[model samples]
Target: MTESRPHALFCFGTLLDPRVQTALFGRTVPTEAATLAGHATRPLAVAGDSVTAAGGRDVRPTLARKLGATVEGGVLRLSDRELAAADDHEIDDHVRRRVTLASGETAWAHLDARPLRAAARIVIVGDSIAYGRCDPEGGWAGQFATAHIAADEHAHRVFNLAVPGSTLADVGEQTPALLPPRHPDTIVVAAGINDSAVPLAASDTGIDGLRDITGPLDALLATARRHHARLVVLGPLWLDESCTGDFEGLRFTAARALELRAALRTWCAEHHVDHLDLWEPLRDRPELFVDGLHPGTEGHKELYRYLSAHHC
Candidate 1:
């Protein structure tokens, strides 16, 4: 067994809330009232009275680095497990940094440093998998972005443009308009499963076979190439055994998935694009998928791990 290390972290945001602390660590650790210099707390809400605040307005507080400013917060000492849990709870918008507290002690703190986007712009376009169905947070997009930030000193923002139940036509229609004016560093296309499997009456009259979708897939790739973006194509994943029986009234068979997968691999090879076979890696892990179709939070974490290792 490995030794557990004692860790210290300064909190000024949601982690400062005792309720959040209890949820993350199971129990609140003893905290010391602390102050951080060279930082200031800013109210995130717009100028509105408490009673007159508009709906959908942000009312949370945020900490910012400012010269000669001081922010009052708490310093928490945590075990290794608690530290890991806290790291997992923080979203991609934050990073841990060393800071000096009012007591003249150094501790780590999560800071909102994602606004400093000094890295590449990554865009993901696809169906439910890219859309992160079932997971509360943004799913694989969030995982990938967060992993990038945590792993590298410099990282990029991941733009998820996937819409659940969308088809090739939907992607063709939305992607051109959704992309930024500037060329992105990387563009991942993970569609085609919906286009090939969805029933004709439900949303789209999906293609009968792989040949039918080649034209559209090529067109999307060609457009991405035109914009000078590095392209990555992800094939569809296998559904759970529970969904072996007719899925979505279209009987989403494994044969159909395999066919689409083959076509995708061929197209990617010809186009000189990176292709990830979602089926191969996830076929054994049925528990990661929820409802025998969509990836759950654990599944999204698995995807993040694979993409981080192979693609990112």
Candidate 2:
């Protein structure tokens, strides 16, 4: 319905967890313990911790398709907003379907769906570009998460592991450590700017020059492929005025950014990972960048728009 209204929802998974219910629906509603017919339940491999049911057993439950079977759950009357929120909480792995309960009541139940589009662990690693330098809240990662939730209606976590002024080597070293606890299904790498900007002496393998991050880039991609099933690598963004004019010996320029972008595009191709070239789409949009280097709020929005059109 267009207007906010109350709707009945059947939860079979971790939605049975009141902590999860409160996180997704804002507040827990009065739920009636109920049962759905002709379905079984199993464990799902998403990021959420195993839920402890009322009987003191930990489980990660997913609805299994079966004939003449029954599954126990609770039904909650949620508002239109909360219903939408519940849908978003389910993410890509689960789809909402109308089903008849054991009590002969037709209610909406979330069922497991496809793999990638279902509930997943998405991680973003990079430098200031991914970090949302100037406008903290408007970072592309945040925008993607919001849009992803709105579109998927399932809870997928986007962990932003980007650091300002971080080189590809830094990301490589951090990736193995970062992936524990919650391994990523899709990992996006947005780096190369810091590698191109910093001085030669500051880098470990910049023996070739400031932008010579081949060693680190290789290390990072290797780590990504090792820990994740799907990978998306992103290139550096465009800068306004050449940082060379601002800082001596620093060769941060549009040309350099383009060069780095091309190199990254080639690398992603070689690795057979999804690649997004951030330079071309954003190069001409001077207003999107705050200072010549980092993106402003609108810049982040533009980045998100470009990502939505190309990758998301």
Best of the candidates, TM-score: 2
For 1-312, candidate 2 gives per-residue lDDT tens digits of 366667889986666678888888777677789987656676765554322333354445677544345888899888888888888766455656555677877677776543223325678888877887788684877888776667645445678888876777778778778886665656678874766664434653354333456677677656654542345677677787643354444546666666677778777666544566777767767777766787888888887887766554
Candidate 2 total steric clashes:
11
Span of 10 residues, lowest total lDDT, candidate 2: 48-57
Candidate 2 positional error at 26, Å: 59
CA lDDT of each prediction against the hidden true structure: 0.67, 0.67
Model 2, residue 197: distance off in Å is 1.8
Misplaced by over 4 Å in model 1 are: 1-119, 149-155, 198-211, 244-246
TM-score of each: 0.56, 0.57
Clashes of 1: 0
Model 1, span 80-136: residue lDDT tens: 889888877665444564556667676777654332221256677888878888898
